[model samples]
Target: MVATTGRGRQGRGRQKIEMKPIQKETARQVCFSKRCAGVFKKASELSVLCGAEIAVLAFSPSSKPFSYGHPSVESILERFFGSSADAAPATPPRHPPAAVLIQALGRQEKELQERLEAGKRRKAALEESLRGPQWGPVGDLLGAWRS
Candidate 1:
């Protein structure tokens, strides 16, 4: 049997990285470029596979903006905001007047706000669960455990 040296294969495998800001500017730029490309690729794949509209905006270390959007960024933004500048004025309203449209939009906004609040609550509960139990005293723990 041949003796094996631990050092031989140790550095060749993947290692868990500590989550922290990269110090060197060059390394940070390289990492940013690679990660940005990877994210954009994933976004593209998700859009294609799920038929979902997507828009991604990112800023580099130098404060330059990068964006990717399916079916054009401007079109997506217009759709999201429910406004379009180039829309033909000659086209007759399929629905009613501006007041009805405004009312409908208000209702939609309210519904979206309610959903947002619910999602925030859910997120907070999940975060609390992940943090485990927090007890000030034995009484608190017992009270929580019992109920």
Candidate 2:
């Protein structure tokens, strides 16, 4: 956790540090930078020490981007967001509505039926071609040799 010294002129301890607006702004910025670095360091250490993949993204006070990750940020994000194919199952299956299941099965059945019909048509066309007039010339030549 990042610690911050309170703002304003009133606080515990002697007035060794003057709490002016400029000084306050400077201290805040410095604290922010330090904390950002600390957080990234901690994240990297945690990933290494525990053998856990981690990704840390921090935006600076100036809106700049900074990031650190173990074994690449893309893999870490993929693991977290279910984009990795090798990632283990993280959630149990939910029971879907029967109506929805029936609708999905119906759609699948329709698709399979269409494919079967197409396949039958293709087979019929192929068989018809093999048995049609196109084979007559070859058959006549072969028949002549047989005769």
Q: Which candidate achieves the best TM-score against the true structure?
A: 1
lDDT of 1 by residue, 1-147 (tens): 344567654333455689899999999999999999999999999888886677888999988898888755665666666656666433243349999889999999999999999999999999987787665588597998999
TM-score of 1: 0.47
Q: What are the per-residue Cα lDDT tens digits for candidate 2 across 1-147?
A: 333466644445544646454346677678768878899889888877886667888776667887887767775676688866877644333358899999999999999999999999999999999887775889789888999
Model 2 regions more than 4 Å off: 1-25, 83-147
How much is 129 displaced in model 2, in angstroms?
99
Q: RMSD (Cα, Å) of candidate 1?
A: 19.7
Error of 2 at 144 (Å): 99
lDDT of model 2 at position 47: 72
TM-score list, all predictions: 0.47, 0.38
